[model samples]
Target: MDITGAAAVVTGGASGIGAATVRMLAARGAKVVVADLNEAAGVALAREVGGSFVKVDVTSTEDLVAAVDEAESLGPVRVLVNSAGIGWAQRTVGRDGRYASAADLDAFKRVVAINLVGTYDAIRLAATAMSRTEPLDTGERGAIVNLSSVAAFDGQIGQAAYSASKGGVVGMTLPVARDLAAIGVRVNTVAPGLVDTPIYGEGEASEAFKANLAQGVLFPKRLGGPSEIASMIVEAVTNSYLNAETIRVDGGIRMQPK
Candidate 1:
């Protein structure tokens, strides 16, 4: 689908891969909305791209609705990127040698709620808005790109919650795409491997740690960049033929069990 002059909403757009996506979309002439929780960063990024910023908590329907509305105000709502998510590391059972202790149920629930449920919430709302728009010459009203992780497939130890949440995204792509076909809305997913994002702290220690992580990559011997993932997302959105597919941007790395 052509992105020029289309309104695009990208959650978690203040930083990381989402930020890169926001920049790329704006560069392509899409009127982008940087939806994120970080007001300071979101505002800065929005200003940088000459787009709007809406503070959003993905779990809240009201917040998402406002974001979609904001996007529509810009022009035809044609793109939605669900990139807000969190990670947790814990075994099903306690790892501190405590017998019968289980992982923090609340943490597990939070991760799934934000990563899985929140994503669906955005998709539903955005697609609804897109359905109201006239289809392009290509007969496509819009496209959605969801952010998953390689962990969804090769989950490591202590990644049960994160994996389950992302795996849910991969699982729903086909069904969601099918459901939205009547409206000419397509859905796809991007499962990225390790990328240099703020989740890792800054400074020498962080660089050293990231280097060790990069050693596992199959080629180039480096961690993926946020722009790399964003490029794939743009492709997924613009390539009308790409639907119900999950593309991995990892450099041929299968994670090991931690």
Candidate 2:
């Protein structure tokens, strides 16, 4: 799909992969909307990319609608990147080996709510807006890219909640694409390995920790970069032939059981 003059909404656009995507899309001549809860970073990045910033909590439909409206105000909404997500770690049964110490139900639900439900909320709102636009020569109105994780498949210990949430994204890709096919909208997903993002802190200790984590990678012997993942996301959006697929940007790491 041609994105020139089109508008794109990127959740979690404040930093990491989302920020990289906003920059790339802007360079491609698409008007971008930085939709994120990080007001400061979102505003800064939007200004740098010559886009608009909308504070959005993905779990909130009202916030998502405002973001879609903001994108529409810029141009036709043709792209949406569901990059906003959160993670939590705890085995279904905790360290104490007792039901009372099992992973907090509230925590698990919160992770699924934010990572899975929030993603769908953004997709539905944006797809609705995209449906209203005129179709292009290829009969395509828009494309969507949702962020999953290697955990969705190669889930390790303590990843139950994160895996379930991301797995839902993978599970829904083809069906969601089929559902939106009638409207000429395509859905795809990108499941990344360990990408270097702010979630990892900086410092000698952090670097050493990350370096150790990199040992598991099949090749490139390092964590993935946000820009690397963003490149694939941009391709997913611009490549009209790619649809209903979940591409793993990881360097062939299958993740070990912890």
Number of the top candidate by TM-score? 2
- Per-residue C-alpha lDDT of model 1 across residues 115-233, encoded as one tens digit per residue: 99999999999999999999999899999999999999999999999999999999999999999999999999999999999889999999999999998999978999999999999
Clashing pairs in 1: none
Worst 10 residues of 2 by lDDT: 90-99
Number of backbone-clashing residue pairs for each candidate, in the order shown: 0, 0
What tens digits encode model 2's per-residue C-alpha lDDT throughout 117-217?
Answer: 99999989999999999999999999999999999999999999999999999999999999999999999999999999978899999999999999999
Superposition TM-score, candidate 2 onto the true structure: 0.98
What TM-score, over all chains together, does every model reach? 0.98, 0.98
Kindly provide the TM-score of model 1 when superposed on the true structure, using C-alpha atoms: 0.98
Q: Which ten residues in a row have the lowest lDDT in candidate 1?
A: 93-102
